[model samples]
Target: MRYDDDPWQVAIWTSTDGTAWELVPDLDSFGRAGLRDIASSDEGLMVAIGYEVLPPEEGSQDPFTQAGKIWRSENGIDWIAVEGIAGQFGDVAYRQGEWVVVGAIDGRAVIHTSADLVNWSTAMLDGLESALGESKAPCPLTGRQRRNGRSLAGWPISAPPSSAPQLAWRSASGAGMHWVGQVDWAE
Candidate 1:
């Protein structure tokens, strides 16, 4: 992960026990990128998702553009950067023989799915419009794979009914996500 103040380096750390950790060396090559989330499959493949900021043209008032970035590793020690899809990826989860990545592009939520991690197919989430309305874009997404093998992706909404956060979940069977639901904090 790259810190806000230090944009030039990205560090990878490994821990066998939760109490002890060691940093992997020579990762300064992943320059000017920030890794947001990382996930590992049952088969031991690991994926990290982030974005690279592209500087605006000289003397232009336009903002910088961002492209999604992905890195894969089998042992969590040596990582290889992979070409990412169009949207800015926030999180990734692997379950039921598929990898699901959640992100946003052009102010719309998008999901990219892949079986082999090298090739991906993108799908814009039209259902997010019904949940978040047409004007608001979902925040950077977060994904989790439950112990039971189900996968969930969600973004917190700051609209009027701020107390109720929205969630989208998929079953362990690798079915399509059900996008409209309130997270019951009481549970």
Candidate 2:
């Protein structure tokens, strides 16, 4: 699922053979007024992130006011919003029997973990505390797990930290890279 442009609407493209693709229409009924990211679980569950904007009260200077939500689908056709998620989530990945979603809340990095995809728990990424006042936009996260029982989460770091993308990985013994900074993607 992605958006190229438009009247700012979302589109779902399906590929049956990995080589050919077709558009799946009538998704406006999904009630996902806006979608940020999506992921699926091996257990046949699909989840998407959506948002509802709330205008700031009078005399407020903040122009970006929004409420984030998570939506779930069984067959990718019908959907319903999951209760309890309170911030924008830009990425999600399922690994090692757990579903992990990362984004930001109140301009701070937040992580959500779930085992069943229905019930979720949230936590703040302590390593990202320095970005609290310096970064306002949600940093999109990409989850990576290696075959050696190592797990990594990468995201573009902002201000007070050199404004470079960093990777943090953990090992089985609970110690690993806290921040491998300034990764060059071109190389």
Candidate 3:
């Protein structure tokens, strides 16, 4: 799982048995920010994605919403940011050795894939099933996403809404990013 902040941050956890869990941190660390989610690639990379909930632009009514950036870490510590993800991004996950992010497309969610967390390409969800909308790929990483419901695709491009899709991805059925079954913000 991950949380939010300035530059963004992520947390990983583990347990011998599902009964007790331990927080995985105090090791390789990324400076704090509003991190939205965490995922791992089979090749051993960690990815975190989110937006900066902060100060407005110096002279405008709002700061140009910073485009979402990708952060990758080897061994879940010591981080690196992937430059050039356009627009405010919502979530991310790593699968196999590929990194996939959930970002808004025309105000709706879309899937993006990156072999390395630094570069990304928005993927076409061909008959891709989402627990929520067609391309609303975000999986709310927090309890807050649990409270909201479904929304229309490509509807929020220019305006803000009370809720947005939570970013999540497919992972191993028993562990990692896939352990949660399915995560959705609007469904």
Candidate 4:
């Protein structure tokens, strides 16, 4: 799994037997970099996506939100930055010979696709709303399933009413959307 250390540096830990883990060293490049999601391409290129929230300047109302970034690694050890793409991007995945990322732009759900992980095109999910009128895809998306030659998609329920979180899953293979299980905090 990939996460940010206490110093806000990206950290990657690997476990083969699901019991013992080994920390990979020197993967941190940016001091204030915090990772949100990561994906590996079919060609062995691994990408980590997240945003760097700058500290609020003097007299500034809010300066927490900053532009997003992408870091690519061929062997998951040494990483290289891919410039020219920036925003509050959440998650990324390599599917169907392309790299697709989903996040919010100006409080709207946006999807970006790239063939070479450099140049990209974006689309806004304007009408993809659930019965509760929660259409925003602000959470990090994950899950890759290729059954009958189609991509499967899934993401968590953003801004749930209760304190506990839930997930909404779907399939590009045309199985429609469904809700997974939920947990109670006071159990």
CA-lDDT, candidates in order: 0.71, 0.64, 0.49, 0.62
lDDT tens readout by residue for model 4, 5-36: 25656678878899999988987564467787
Name the best candidate (by lDDT).
1
Clashing pairs in 4: 68-87
Off by over 4 Å in 4: 1-6, 61-63, 128-148, 154-187
Which candidate should be chosen as best, given TM-score against the real structure? 1
Whole-model lDDT, model 3: 0.49
In candidate 1, what are the lDDT values of residues 1-187, reduced to their tens digit? 2133455567778888888998988775566776888888989999888877567667766565456788888877667888746777878888768888888877677778888987888767666666565655433555554633446676765555667667666556766767646665444
Greater TM-score among 3 and 4 belongs to 4
Q: TM-score for every candidate vs. truth?
A: 0.77, 0.70, 0.50, 0.67
Better of 1 and 4 by lDDT: 1
Q: Can you rank all candidates by TM-score, best first?
A: 1, 2, 4, 3
Summed backbone clashes in each candidate are 0, 0, 19, 1
Q: Give stretches of model 1 more than 4 Å off.
A: 1-7, 61-65, 127-139, 145-150, 158-162, 184-187
Q: Candidate 2, TM-score vs. the true structure?
A: 0.70
Return model 3's CA RMSD, one decimal. 10.3
**Model 1 reaches what TM-score against the true structure?**
0.77
Weakest lDDT window of 10 consecutive positions for candidate 3? 150-159
